[model samples]
Target chain A: MRLRNGPAASVRYEGILRICAIGLAVFSLLSWLLLGANRGWTKTTRTRWQKDPVTEIEGPLIEKAFLPGVDLLAVGLSGALILFVVSLLVTKNKTNSNQVNSSS
Target chain B: MKNKFVAALGFIALAATAFAAPLEFDFKDPKGVNNVIFKTDAPLESINGTATGISGNVTFDPDNPGAVKGKIVVQSASLHLGNPMQKEHLHSDKWLDVTRYPEITFEVESAKNVKTEGNVTTADVGGKMSLHGATKPITVPVKMTFLKDKLKARTGKEGDLLVIRANFKIRRSDFRINPGQMEDKVSDDIELNLSIAGAAPRG
Candidate 1:
């Protein structure tokens, strides 16, 4: 049987992309919270104005960030997450147009 | 005879003042003991490091603490970031470019808003600090203690030691360090904490 580009089929495909986007967003937020909490991050928030010890993690010449328990690899994963969200957006828009055309 | 005594006293007074004037200091060996420290509080984890090879001197006055001037320099290549690759990335051409700009210098031009409390004196210090190949005028709040305080602490004879504890903040954007990366994770304002305890000239 042929996979038809019908309105119903397009909606189903778009549903998957929409769900993926939401799932990725939720994952990032949760990682930021749970991972941040895991790495000994305090409950209080810190701003730039308050003076933190110079001896703490970030030094003069280098700056590397990771979620609490996760190390540098977390940065690469975050980048991938961003790409996934962008891809989902593009695919969903394409699916929407396809549905409109088939319905018309 | 009385006139002669007064002239003799005047000569000694001049000599003492000259001796009490600012004396310069050279950086100590293995400069890692006293160095430049920087820290950033990111959402993920805090990143920190220290740059050694700290070289420079201060012309500090024990007699008149307000009259002080000097510059401290941190060798870029000597920075210890705890990771060889991370250190390399920081010193790379994109960042500090250790080859092109090998040093970050903080020149203390003068001191202002000077006030003293017992053995401790605090001042608003004016200086020009250059970082990442960019130089800017900066005034930092500093607390100073004459070496004599050390002598007092030890109940020993007062010698030539001056302690300067200066903590200040500068925006990384001010020096154009990856300024275009608006989404950078590092904090824009960088905290600089310097503790320099060494000798000075005292008449």
Candidate 2:
């Protein structure tokens, strides 16, 4: 049997790509927010600033720092962009193929 | 008159001897509260890390602040960034080379412009700092507070506490750290802030 290569197949591919793009974007946002939405680079450790009452010195002590930072956002956004671009290419290829078939 | 002058001179000599005696402060804090923060800010990227593996001894005379002498050493491998990958890179051969040079040290040779107010003594400490593989003479402005018999409050031990604070800047290239490369990502100037409390327990 021949594989489907028309409007139906194109629509299916577009739907899958759109879903993947949305999923990646959502994942990135959720992960970034969960990881404290750090504006700087990704950090594996988090710190809590504390002051020693006796010495009166303030410093950061490591808290639960195993959290990702803006790097997660970058990765997720980049993945979404690639998927969106692929979807556009798929639509263009389907239109071209249909045009060629009709001309024959 | 001569006997009176000789007795006065002897009293002055005794007072000077008492002032010259230094208290040795051991900086190997078991509480893990001591830390040195190192920061690099470049046009493209800024990095911050902390080193907690600090140990050394400093001979500080509160009565004679200008005669201070000591060595402070930080473990190279103890330097850590928030990012694990970046931390690994920092400890790698191309960066700090932690395996080759395990200790970053600053040995104090002299102090200048020493000033004392209350329990705090501030001075420009001249020291030879050995980092990466090169040793450079650097002068760091240090403020030290000698808390007499206050170690019990922090560690539940009867001792004296010496709180030291210093802020200094160093050129990474001077220490041969990736000289002339990745300047956009890693700044050549490394800003360091050291805050440590040394305990000298009395018998």
Candidate 3:
């Protein structure tokens, strides 16, 4: 092609996929950690049990953006991770198939 | 003399039965409400909000105010401040961190120095209260209405209704709500007052 100093085209595509996977991993982890407890609250002192209903507390942006219904978000992240792994497997399978074909 | 002793024993047994009878009810009345009010520094106005999702019970004897005991639990996530930004900070990690802790509970283990005047009775209700994350034992001065006739008329039922109110101050630092400079804007000593509308069958 007419590329000046850029890396090979296939290498660029692989790099993009790697970056995407890393980003999704971070997003998924942060969302899971931030979800914390879905509901319920208790106030306690040094000596007693104070069990009560779940009162609405102000949640942070991380919580507001990713929690409560975060199970869906987690599922989406897992799907993306699975796709990444699948792609890797397909690439490996194709390489093996090509090697066998060449040998034949 | 033997007859007199038997009569004395019968009277003592009757008193024990009266003293042991328990009055119990839930805070499930739709019309019932719980509210908490707190004041900030001079520049900031005091804040008040309605407490929802409240459910608890009280069990005690009118014949003996000192034997009264119960516990109530309030959900932390239900705290609502009309303003958006203020609510955010108040529940953040620096303040309440409601995400970390979801409920605030208070249990009455005992009562002491019980005294009554007219329909209003006062007692040193000793209990363990848990807020934020720390649990502490404190003796709260409680005032309650102990009149069966008045409560019976109000509830439109023959059951007993008791109205209890307790006021106390707690140090925020003790629970790690906000420490250091944050304490300046919001006082370390946060005032908490609880007024409970509880009821049960007459003993």
Chain A TM-score relative to the true structure, per candidate: 0.38, 0.81, 0.43
TM-score of each: 0.60, 0.89, 0.56
Q: Write the per-residue lDDT of candidate 1 for residues B32-95, one digit (tens) a residue.
A: 3455677766554466666657778887766676887888888888765554555677789877
Worst 10 residues of 2 chain B by lDDT: B15-24
Candidate No. with top TM-score: 2
* Docking quality tier of model 1: incorrect
Candidate 2 residue-wise lDDT, A1-104, digit = tens: 12266777887898899899999989899988976788888886886667787877666687656576777789989999999898888888778777878999
Model 1, position A101, has a per-residue lDDT of 72
Looking at model 1, residue B81 earns an lDDT score of 56
Model 3 chain A lDDT-worst window of ten = A40-49
Which candidate order results from sorting by lDDT in descending order?
A: 2, 1, 3
| TM-score of candidate 3 against the unseen true structure | 0.56
**DockQ, each predicted model:** 0.04, 0.54, 0.01
Of the pair 1 and 3, which is ahead by TM-score? 1
Candidate 1 wrongly placed segments (more than 4 Å):
A1-69, A72-104, B1-12, B29-31, B149-159, B182-184, B200-203
**Which CAPRI category fits model 2?**
medium
